[model samples]
Target chain A: MERIPILKMGKFLIVSIQVDMHDELALALQEDLAEQIVKTRAKGVLIDISSLNLVDSFTARILGNMTAMARLLDAETLVVGMRPAVAMTLVELGVSLRGIRTAGNAEKGMALLEAIVAQQAKSNAPKST
Target chain B: MPPKVRDTFTVRSDHDVVTVRQKARQLATELGFSLVNQTKLVTAVSELARNMVVWGGGGTVRMEIVKNGALQGVRLTFEDHGRGIPDIEQAMKDGYSGGSGLGLGLGGAKRLVDEFDIVSRVGKGTRVTITRWK
Candidate 1:
């Protein structure tokens, strides 16, 4: 079965969506990512969607669901490379992905993940008296 | 006289939704629309195509390239003979989705296009037409 590749970088996972996925594929990806996060104990997830030019409501909902699921596993999801047009359409469609983080590109998204993970470490670390 | 160009594609499943979006984008690009306009049009097509499959139980998408004097545009019509909408006005509202959706299907598509029209009957079928000018 064809699947979206999920690469692990230290404590984060990178998923770049290159195809205009069908609903089944999107759902599969969500499930796979969640399982990976738990198995690998990842701290953050970065999803690159720069190649995806079209995102319908179903796609939008699935992305949102994936982000929420990641959060439940103690991992942050930052979606990067959203085209300007896609942003406009998402807002118009009323699918405000409020909980998910976003960035302009991979470089920026990586920075965001690093900061978030670092913050989590700080907050989670035992306090020194 | 304006050019008359029309094409039809089937929408049977989620995969077909992507096909329709691709066709819509190609038509919009060929029509010399801006990237933003092309994206908006394609997104609208995506929403309608999904509705046809999920709600209308599969249908056909008709694409037409139209020109009115100096203005050129792409017109899309989605027709399905499945469960038709009972109240179009309610369905057109921003948050009135009958299915498990954001309820932006009809209204959002309308906002993205320059012209929108829809007709449906309770037991017969439904047809939605939308157009965006370049």
Candidate 2:
């Protein structure tokens, strides 16, 4: 797994989460982040939670909400690089995923997002016109 | 918000939720719940406890272990007598926060546990109970 530093790719909200994010703060940020993505009509999103310590119920809910909002705006969200301990803590805290997809790292998430774009392109491409 | 506690567990701060979480987790484990399930229950309890303190104006995290037949799961009731919820349906909406603490949101907590119910009044208080059964 290669370390992919956070960068703005094309048109998407790239949030590199840290370990000390308060649950409320995270939730507030998600609202703004999701709104920005929707307002801009970004392609997709990559949330890097590699440094998160414990994603409590509130934080998890925000992530879940973000996923829903992104979908409403026709954008995909991929949670990337969640630590196993943090993930388990979140599970214990009963953080609902709300059907948001997850990935091992940023590289894979980006690749998957790009794949979706490619697939959409092929499907929507004109038939030999 | 303010709530009068009748029995077990005096909740002073939000951390008192740790006790509720500990007790609930143990009970869930004894009932043969998977580790994952136990964690979810604990988290739900924590949320309720926080709500009691934050929105309900600091009440109590009552832990009731019913030894009666047909009802075996450990039940946690967060009783708070603060300004009750004005609208439950709106409160359940995602990102509907109108308070000081993490919004003391109910939607996620409700989603985490097997059983969840709440009762409240505008000027009375709020009581939220959740249980996880195996």
Candidate 3:
């Protein structure tokens, strides 16, 4: 079985989708990301789709599901680098990708993720009385 | 002028779905469709092709380069001989799904293209034909 590589960077996991993923591959990525989140105790997951040209409802649903799953596991998932054409198509296709955060590119996405993690840490920090 | 070109592909597995999307993208690009139009057509193809693999239990897709007057376009026909849709009206709704999908396949695909037509018979199969002009 083929798998998309998930790179762990400190408290974040980055997945760059470079292939035209099939249905099974997308599902596998979802499951694999969940397991990795638990194992690594990661705080954020960044999915870069700049190399992908199209995102159908099936893929969109998987992405949406991934974000939901990651949320339950206490992680933030940010999908970045969507092509302008793909974004137009997604809206016309009526897949809102609800509950999923997005950024223009990986750098911006990373910065946003850092901010989110920092915010979370600040809130989670115990009072030093 | 060149004659119309038609090609057929089988949609039996997940890989086939990706192939269909690629082929559709190629055809749309060759027809000089704008980038956004190409994406929309390819995305629509992805949805319909996956429908054949997941719900229809495999099928065939026919890609045709069509011309009308001076306009060029790509037309695709997806046929599947699996369990046919019982209620197409409900299935076309955005939130309706007979399987584990977002129920946006048919309606969404239709929205992305310029022309859409569907024919289905219970206990038989379904055929969807769509076209996008450039």
* Candidate 2 Cα misplacement greater than 4 A, ranges: A1-7, A89-98, B1-46, B53-55, B59-134
Model number with the top lDDT: 3
Residue A52 miss distance in model 1 (angstroms): 1.4
Question: Which regions of candidate 1 deviate over 4 angstroms?
Answer: B1-3
- True-structure lDDT of candidate 2: 0.69
Using all chains and alpha carbons, the TM-scores for the candidates as numbered come to 0.95, 0.53, 0.97
lDDT of 1 by residue, B14-133 (tens): 889888899888888877888889988998998899888989999999899887887888998899999899989989988777574577889989989999999999888999999899
Candidate 3, residue B82: lDDT: 89
lDDT of 1 by residue, A14-101 (tens): 9999988987788889989999999999999999999998777778888889899999999999999999888987887677887879
Candidate 1's displacement at residue A109, Å, is: 1.1
Indicate the residue-level lDDT of B103 in model 2.
Answer: 44
Assess the local accuracy of residue A12 in candidate 3 as a C-alpha lDDT between 0 and 100: 97
What are the per-residue Cα lDDT tens digits for candidate 2 across A1-129?
212233456866687876344344565676677667756778788898887644565567677877887888878889999877557756534444759899999899988988886787798889995
What DockQ does each listed candidate score?
0.74, 0.11, 0.87
- Candidate 1 structure lDDT: 0.89
What is the Å distance of residue A70 in model 3 from its true position?
1.1
Chain B only, TM-score of each candidate = 0.95, 0.81, 0.95
Better of 2 and 3 by lDDT: 3
